[model samples]
Target chain A: MTKIVVLVKQVPDTNAKIVVSGDRVDLSAVKKVMSPYDEFAVETALRHRDASGGEVIALTLGGAGADKVLKDAKAIGVDHIVRIDCEEELDSNSLQSALASTLQEMGAEIVYCGKSAADTGAGSTGPGVAERLGWASASNVTSVGFDGGLTVVAPSDGGNARMSVNTPAVITCDKGDIKVRKPNVKGIMQAKKAQVEVKTAAIQPSSVTIVAHSMPPAKPAGKSYEGGAAAAEVANLLRDEANVI
Target chain B: MTELIVIAEIAKGTIHTTTSELVTAANALGGSPIIIVPCTDASVADAAGTIAGASKVIAAKSDAFAHYDAAAWAEALDAVAPQGTILTSATPQSKDLAARLAARRNLSVVQDVVAISQNQLTSPVYSGKAMQTVAISGPAVVSVRANVFDAAPSTGSNEISVVDTTGNMATAVQEFMARASQRLDVAEANIIISGGRGMGSPDNFVHLEAIADTLGAAVGASRAAVDTWEAIPHSMQVGQTGKTVNPNLYIAVGISGAIQHLAGMRSSKYIVAINKDADAPIFQHADYGIVATWEEALPVLQSTLAGMMA
Candidate 1:
């Protein structure tokens, strides 16, 4: 059976009001859920597993808040799950190292992750893991498939490029892919008993640090260009003022 | 002085316009900056020479480095920026690479920054949901979004020393494809005119395009407009997580002005909003507000302005 691993992150929902307190996200009123992009990764893995008959493993590193995501993954058809609950929040480098070690522990023919976590919008975990593990990786992929090895559709400078690669590779799923499917009633029932192993990360010397964070400035009030001829005023603003041509 | 490393991206074998903006930003931080050139293209190296504030330029050449790969970049950065902080544009490619690099270093990745200094950093949180002020606690890696800072004029002689650092990483770039566009980038445009869902159909965009053509300005859209309207190009998307712009004048038509959409163009010196709804959110941000149908309003503005131009 082809062995596949998908990296998942539990994040705040898209519509939630995130309070930026200092450099950290103020989670006081936020409701945590599986990051939306990870759903694409999980969907891609399950689709591949369904088509080629493989064992799909879901992996994550976070505090206890990530349990729901693992459960959601199992309900959605992941065969196995690993929850690496770290003592400290693993930065991207430490997370990559830990994931490399995890991938070594659970050898797989392919690995997948979301292009970015919506909450943080970091867009780094997949590439970090791929680099640390010395695996070839592709990111911002809108579509993915395994023909001889791997074929993915990714955003290029102007349009999309279909990329082909071999196995033992990493692919980060981007937006515009098919929306992820919800878990069926039977799958949800089975997910309750799915094997979940929690491990603590062991790594040192994380290079990145979040020193602070802030919100964007308020825009000055707006002035409307009414009527069909408003386009002319717009033209004037663009030429004489904005110079954005 | 501590060494500052700036990852200057070159698209299609040439230095991107954002490179000058970033180098100028680094100069404001009071340092001779180091530029990292990932591709083997010689013209890109020459363009780095034009960045008047740099002390050194490190060129890493490889087939694999040409494509935008965060993994390949992490390895390259590991080789060059082991002890120093890695800085990049807050673009999609750079955001991914910087975050992953920061994670590998076990440092926090600060993103979407509008302002940066030695002690304090300003970035948009919640996808332009709100602005937050952060302080650096450690030697951290940072990714700054384009248009966050004023372009700093070049001040030094055009001397560049090249360093090679591709030996540490063992990967090659398979390919690179550039996004094609004839209009100016939203971030680079001095004036921008945007349409919202209220523009109706893709066919109606010709009017907006005509205005844009007249002013020689770039056209943009909110997320809703991009998703629903066929008129706007994908490259002209401006929203919370989309391109950030700082034009001198911004004109919005039929847009209600959600906070997320406004954040992208809020930096524009002048803002004009046009909407039929008296209570449109856009009116809250517009310096000039006209409450009328875009179809009706646009023609009046066009004729009135055309008469003035004539």
Candidate 2:
């Protein structure tokens, strides 16, 4: 059977107001949900497992609260859920190492994840994990078709490129024609009773460290133009002041 | 002085603009970086040698280097650049290559870096909600955001060095394909004009295109417009779930300034919003705003911009 693993993360709702306090972001009052893109990842994994006759497992490396995202994945038809209970911030290198080892232990042949984390926006985890495992990897894949091999379509400069890769590969999903499916009543009820198997991950020493956090310099108030007639002035400002045109 | 290595990007045997931008970034960090051009031909080294502020250019050529195979590029770069910080442009190909190099070297990687100093680098985290400054001690890999820094101009000619690997390759690219020519990606363009549901229909995008052509800007769309209209493809989407752009000038027409949309283009140097509702949330972030319908304002604006350029 094809053993597929989908990596997911819990992030603040896209509309949540971010409050920065003393070089740290405060998320005390923010509501967290499955990252929007991860929903697509979950959908992709379920479809692949169903078509290929395999088991789909949803995994996350986050704190206790991260269980919510796993549970959400269960509601979306994932068969198994696991969470690596850790709170320490991991740099990309250490994180990829930890996850690669975990996936290896599980004997997962195909791995899927969102192109990037909504919070960090570092679209490196999937490819990073693939590299650590010495496996083929594709990023920003829009569509997936399997016929003896995995064929995926990813956006290029202006068009899309169709690529083929062998299994034991990592695919970072992008929102394309795949519209994430919604959970039915029965699925939601079953997910509420599902248990998330939690375990600790071996945290590795980080090479990069966060020294400080600050707000980007605020842009000065821009000059306003009244109506369509102000277009000439806008053009002049774009050419002279901004030097963009 | 510390040594810096830059991974030069090449297109059609010519150095990409991002390579010059990397040179500018390296110059800011206090070093004359050596450029590494990985290509199928050694002649591309001539183009790499012309980049300003570079000390030397290393031409890494192999049959497997014809197309962008992340594994091949990573192996090639790792073989030549054993130590020191390595920098490249932050694109899908380069980011994948950087991540692979980081894993292979077991070093830290700072992706999409916007500012770099001697030891500290600043990059946007949480989709531009906050910025994190990281401290690096030993070897590291970093990818800079495109168009954020000025492209270093051609100044001094540098020496070229070639490294030939006739048979050494781990992976090979079976095919290489690119989008149609002359279409600037939203992320790489200096100016972008994006439309939203306020545009009313897909037909109204032509108005945006008229202005876009006049200003040499790429056209983008809000998620709302893309989702609502079948004519608008996901490729044109610029939002939290779509392409994140850091253009110089961003014009939002008929967009309501959704936070998701703001996350993508808020880093743009200049923003202009045109909507009929004076209370549209987009006005809060726009550098300049006009309270008029696109119908009433676009034609006049297009004509005025054409006249200005003429």
Candidate 3:
């Protein structure tokens, strides 16, 4: 069976308000869920696994607090799940290194992950993993095609490019045309009782250090005009003040 | 001053406009920059030599350059480019390249840098909910966002050198088929018009496209629209998980401005929102707000703007 691994992350719900206090972003009050882009990745993995006989594994780094997101993936019928038990906050380099090591030890072929995590939004891990593993990777992929080999539709400079890449490759998913499936009643019960396989990786000291963290400056109370009557005025302002026309 | 090396982006066999922006960004770092053009042709390197603010241009040409394989491209470029800070555009493709180069070289890689100085780089973190500034201590690979810097003026002749890299490449990627042109990506567009589920139907996005055509803008969709309608592809989604667009003018029609959507386009210079509900969150962030249904407001707005342009 083709062994496929999906990199999953737990992020605050998209609608939750983010609060920053004392040089730290406090997401304690927010409800955590699977990162939006990863949902699409999971869907793509399941589709590929269904088409070709394979075992789909969902992997994450953070523990306990991230269990819900793993269960969420399991509830959707992923075959197995694992979480790296790491407590220290890692920089991009260290994080990528840990993930790359895990994938190598797992002997995973054709890894799938989101282009960027919703939390860091760094967009580094997927490509970084491929670089470290010395494997080919296709990112921002809108479509995946399988024709006795791996082919993917990715965003290029002007339009899209459909490229065929070798296996043991990393694929970073974009939402594309995918619609994630909702978990069924049986799957939910199975997921709630699913046993999570535990693993650990060496967390290295980070080269980069955060100087400070702060919120963006608040926008001024904007002028609201009622109805279609203000359309002409807004147009005139675009030309007169904004000069964006 | 640190030796800042710039990697020029080539799109469809020509040097991209973002390379000029990257050069201008290098100027901000208080260093002379060298341009590295990875291409199959030499004129692309000659084009980079014309982009001012760079000391020299190195054309890293290869047969493998015809397609992008992250490992192959990273190894090829790393072999030719100097052992110093690498600066390129924060564009999606380049950001991926930045990560690869940093990983291969064991250097720090900072992606999507909006502002930079001699010693530190600042970028949005946690999906734009907050901004984090990091101190640059050593050699690092930094990706600068497009449109955040001035295009370096004076396209003068700089010295150019060409080095073929097929000898250096361990080619793996194969058969790249480029589809014909589509509308501008929202991240690169100066003006954008976006629609949400509030538009009621995905087909109504064509109306948004009509206005976009009038303004030469890109059409975008909210996450809700993408999730609700299969017809709406995620490529057009402007949200926390989709794209972060910093356009000159962002017109949001039939969008209630969810926080995730706001996180993407809130950095736009001027925002104009139109929605049926009067209390929609979008009005708070919009410079000009119109309270009306898409049916009532779009036709008038498009025609009025068309008349002004004409």
Candidate 4:
């Protein structure tokens, strides 16, 4: 049986307005939710478990706040839930290293995660952790199959490539055709009472540091046109002013 | 001085323009870059050797290059790449290699770098809600986002090195299915015109498509459109949960401009919003706002745009 592990990250709700206060991104007022793509990964993992008879475990990073995503995964019927307990910010290397070691300790045979997290939008965890564990990684994937072996269909160069790999590999998911399932009332109640296993990882010195944060430069006010009469002007403006046409 | 290495971007066994973009990025960081093109044939090096701003070009000729096997590619590229800063364009293929290469050497990796100033790398965090700037203490592998760094005139001549790392690769390629239709993806499109559920029906997207065809723009959909209509695939979605785009011109028709949708395309150079409701949030960010329905505005806009093109 395959030991499937899906990585989930908690991110600010997409609708939350980000504010910068003194070189820091103020996310305190924003509500957190599961990274949208990670839900797709969890759904794929759940399907794999159902078809192949393997246990699916959901893993998350950070402090108590991250437990919510794990519980969300649990509510969707993941076999187990765990968290990496660290309060401090770790750079990309340290973050990937911690995740790599934790997966190794968990005896993970196959790993699944989002193509990239919505928070950082830094699609590193899958390939980075796969490299640390010396395993193959198929990223930006639509489908992951397990009939004869592990196969994945990933988009590349405006085409789709069907690839197969050995075990002990990491797969990063894209939405593809999979329709994500929502949790039911009974599942939600079970997840509300689920206890999460917490563990600490071996931290390493970080090679990178976030020195500052800022908002993108604001744009000047735009022109407004009313009714269909302005359509001709808009087209003319695109040519003369925007120079895009 | 730390050596700057650029991993050339190859599409369909041919060099891509992103090679120069990577070279331009490396030059901006105050270094003469050496580009390495991963391939099984040495002929690939000839074209890359001519890219401007690079000091040298090395073709890492390898059997592992038969197809894009990440494990094999990382192992082969590692042998030729020296200890230094690695620079590449943030494409799906190369970004995967960048992370694996960094992990092999125990180095740090920064992806989707939009700006580099005074040894600091800045990228969008929280999906473009806030930008984070990071300082690298030492050598790191960085992937620069396409169409961001400014290009300047530079010099380059022929100094080529070829390394052969022909080894057994584990991953096997079963088949490659090319998409039949020549539709451009929203991520790679220079111009995009997106529709929302307000279009009334999926079939109404034909008007958007006609407009897109005239301007050579890709057709995109809001999350609402993709959810409301099964005909619209998720690939056409442009939003936080969908593909993030940074096109030159983004046209939003009949969309209410949800924060999630804006989060993806906010970086577009110019935005045009067409909606019946003037109070829609999209108008707040659009460079040009039109208060009219698609049925009323699209015909004129399409004919006008077609006339301009003609």
Question: Highest TM-score among the candidates is held by which one?
Answer: 2
- Using all chains and alpha carbons, the TM-scores for the candidates as numbered come to 0.83, 0.94, 0.90, 0.94
Q: Candidate 2, which CAPRI tier?
A: medium
**Residue A242 error for model 2, in Å?**
2.1
Best by DockQ: 4
lDDT tens per residue, model 3, B142-196: 9987767877776668899998876333224344455332677787788999999
Q: Fnat of candidate 3, please?
A: 0.69
lDDT of 1 at B233: 59
Worst 10 residues of 1 chain B by lDDT: B167-176
Please, what are the lDDT tens digits per residue for candidate 2 over residues B16-90? 888999998888877889998887888877877678898898998787676565666677778876477889888
Give the chain B TM-score for each candidate. 0.78, 0.91, 0.90, 0.91
After best superposition, candidate 4 residue A126: deviation in angstroms? 0.4
Interface RMSD of each: 4.6, 2.5, 2.5, 1.8
Candidate 4: clashing pairs of residues: A119-B126
Q: What are the per-residue Cα lDDT tens digits for candidate 1 across B131-230?
A: 5556655566777776556654555556554545553332233454455656656755667888888888767777777766766677888888887855
What is the per-residue lDDT of model 1 for residues A37-125, given as tens digits with 9 covering 90 to 100? 78889999998888788799999887676778999999988988898877575555566778788787888678989877766566777
Candidate 1 docks at the CAPRI level of acceptable
Q: Fill in the DockQ of model 3.
A: 0.55
Could you say which candidate leads in lDDT? 4
Q: Could you give me the TM-score of model 4 versus the true structure?
A: 0.94
- Cα lDDT of candidate 2 equals 0.83
